[model samples]
Target: MRTIESYLRMLLIMTLCYLIAEWVIDEPKGTVLFNPYVLGFLFFIFLLVISFEVIIGVLERIADQLTTPEQRVALEEAKKQKALENKWKKRFAEWLIGKQTTPEAQLILEDHNYDGIRELDNPLPPWWLYLFYLTLIFGVVYLGYYHLFGGSDQKQNFEQEMAMAKEQIETYKKTAASFVDETNVTVLTDASSLESGKSLFEIHCAICHQNDGGGAIGPNLTDNYWILGGDIKSIFLTIAKGGRPGKGMIAWNNSLKPQEIQQLSSFILSLNGTTPQNPKAPEGTLINQ
Candidate 1:
C-alpha cells in the first residue's frame, strides 16, 4: 500500500475494469467519465482502494505485534535498504526542480519584510524554466510558419470549414433521402417534392391507380374509401411493404427511394375529393374525414 507498485496495480485494475465495462456497454457518445455506469465503477474503485488500504494497514499492525525484536530490526534494515535502492528516483525528482535551499540555508532578504515575514532568495524550478523555454521556441516556429509564410488565418480557416460543412450537408441530404422507413415516413408537401412524386406515380403507379388516381384495376383513390387504413403512416407502410397478401399491390420499398414514396403518398392524399374522368367505383370501407 505504501509502494508505487501498489498504486500502479490499482490503476491497472481500474483501467481493465473500465475497458470491460465499455466493451459491454459500447456507448461512444458523450463524456466517458460522466456516463452513469462509468461513474458507478469509479465509485466502486474508490471503495475498493479504501478497503485495500484499511486491510493492509490492519495486517501490517498485526504483523508488527507478532514480530520479535530481531525481526523488527531486520524489517527496519530491509526498509533502509529499499530506500537506498530508490534513492536515485528521489535525486532525479530533485534534479527536475533545480537546486533548492533548506530552511536553515535559505538567505532571508534584509529589506523585504511584511508582518515579520521575510522573503527568501529562491531559484526558479528547472521544470518551469524548461517549459518557458519550450514556449519561446514554439512561439518563434509558429510566427515563422504562420505570419511570415502567409499560412491560412482564422477567416480563411472558417471559410474552409464552412465549405466542408456545406459539402457534408449536401452528401447527407443525398443519402438521407433513402434513410427512411414506414416508422419515420411523412408526407412531403413542397411543390418540387410533389412534382417529383407525381412523376414517380405516373411512371410506376398509373397502370393500376390510373393517370389521375381515379382508380383503374385498383380501388378508388379519389374517394375517402381505402383498402387499407388511409392515414399517412398506414399509407407509407402500404407503399413500402405492399398491401395484403399474394394478389395485393407489389411492394414499392425496393423500387422507389423513401423520399419518392413520401412524395407519392402526399400526392395520393391530395387526390381525395377531386373529380376525375371515368372514375372507378369505391370498393373499401369509407373513412370519415
Candidate 2:
C-alpha cells in the first residue's frame, strides 16, 4: 500500500549515505573521491525528492481526516503500508548481515560452555570473506611481481612520464609558438607586430629612451649608431642580454618574452632616422646590413 515515492525516497537516502560513507573513508588517502559539483547536484535531487514526498504525504493525511469512511480507509492503508515497509526492511537486513539465530550461529553458541554468557557467533557474510581472501592473494601476487621478480618500478614510471612530457613540448615547439631568442629571431615587419612592439617599448623603454624614441638617459634609439651593434640581431641581443659591463643596460630577456623582444627590436629598427628632440649622440658601431 506504500506509494512508490516512499520506496524511491528510501533508496535515494541509502545511496546518499553510502556515497558519504565512502567519501569519509577515502578522504584520508589523498585521492579525490568525488567531484564537489556532482555531490551538490545529488544533494539538490535529494532535497527535491524529500520535499515532494512530504507535500504529498501531508495532503493525503489532510484529505483522509475530512470524512470517517476516508479516515478508516486511510488507517487501513497506513497499516498495510507499515507492514509492507517492515517486510522489505527485514529482508534487506537479513540479506546484508545474514539471518539471526541460524544453525551455524547456534552451533557456535552451543560449542562454547560459558557460565551465563552466549557468544553470538554469527558467521561473516560470504561476500565479505571472499573479498578478504582476495586481498590476501592479491597482496602475495603483488609482492612477488613487484619486489621479488622484475617489473615496472616507480622510477621507470616517473622517467617515462617525464619523457612523454618532453616529447609533447618538442612537438608544441614545432607548431610556431616556440621560444624565440635574439640569435635565431628575425625582425617582424608586419603592421600588427610593429604596433604591438611600439606599445611595449613605450611602456618599458620609454623611461630611459623617453617618449617618441628620443634619447634621455639612454642612447638615441633612432640613430644608426649603436654601442652594442646596430642590426636587428644586435639590437635584439642588446635588448635581451643587456649592454657591456656598467653601460647601464641590463638583460631584458627576463622582463620580455622572446616574441615581445623580437617585436620591440623590429620597432627599434624602424626608428632609424626619426627626428627626436634632445636626442643623445649615437655611441655604437653602425652596421649597414
Candidate 3:
C-alpha cells in the first residue's frame, strides 16, 4: 500500500541512513570531526530534514481538525486515487512477469494434465526474447570481426603497442640521448661532460671505487691493468652492465641514463696512469700496451 506520503517518508529514511554511514567512515577514532566543514554540512542537512518533517506533520494534523464537508469529499477523492494507483501497480507487475491470465481467457489452458493439474499455454516475454536475440547477434559479430576478419585481438594490440613504444624509444635515442653499448662507445673528450661524469661517479659509484676511481674494494681504475677491458667501449659495457658476480660492481644502466654512462666511461678512461694515494695493486691483463 503506497501513497505519495509514504514515498516521501522512504526518501527521508534513506537520507538519514546515508548520513549515518558518512559520519562513520569520515573520522578515525580519537580524531574529532576530521573534516569539520563536511560533517557540519551533513549535520545541517539532518536538522533541515527533521524540521521539514515536523512542519509537515503539524500541517497534516491541522488540516484533519479543520475538515469541512468539501474537504471530506476531497479526502474521499484522494482515497479513490490511491486505489487506482494500486490497481495499476498490480497490472504492471503482472505484465512485467508475463505470467498473468484473466478469468475469461479459458482458451489458454493446455491439454497436458497430471492427476488434477494442467499447465497454461504461455510464451516467453517479448522483451526477454528480443534481448536474447540481440545478444546472439552481438556474439556472431564479435567472433567474425575479431577472428575471421583479422581484426586486432588483445595479443595483437599488446604487441603493436610494444612495437610502437620500442620505435618511439629508438627515435628518441637518435634525436636526444643515444644509447651506448660496447660496439658503439667512444671516449668523450669534452671537459664539461667529463666533469659531470666525475660528479656522477663520486655520488653513485664512490662507495666501492673510492672517491677518485682509485679502486679499493674493486679493481684499481688508475693503473694500466684491466680486470675487464680497458678500451672506451669495454669500459662502457662493464660499467653499464656490470662485471661478473662477486666482482663488486653492479649495473649502473638502470640508475644512469645511456649518455651519462657514456660520459662516465670517458671519465674513467681519462684517469688512466694518474696517481692515487696507496692505489690497489693492478690485477688483470695490462691494457696500456
lDDT of 3 at 48: 72
Evaluated at residue 121, the lDDT of candidate 1 is 69
Q: For model 3, where is the 10-residue window of minimal lDDT?
A: 1-10
- Candidate 3 Cα errors over 4 Å, as ranges: 1-120, 146-152, 177-185
Q: Give the TM-score of candidate 2.
A: 0.52
lDDT of 1 at 88: 82
Clashes of each: 0, 2, 0
Tens digits of per-residue lDDT, candidate 1, 105-183, equal 5855557779998876677778788899999999999999898998898999999999999999777866775666666
- Predicted candidate 3 versus true structure: per-residue lDDT over 197-247, tens digit per residue: 899889988788877778888888888899788888788888889999877
10-89: candidate 2 lDDT, tens digit per residue: 68785876576566655644333365755666667678778888898999889777769876888889987886879987
- Clash pairs detected, candidate 2: 226-284, 227-284
lDDT of each: 0.81, 0.79, 0.78
* Residue 117 CA displacement from its true place in model 1, Å: 2.5
Count of backbone collisions within predicted model 1: 0
Q: Report the lDDT of model 1 for residue 71.
A: 92
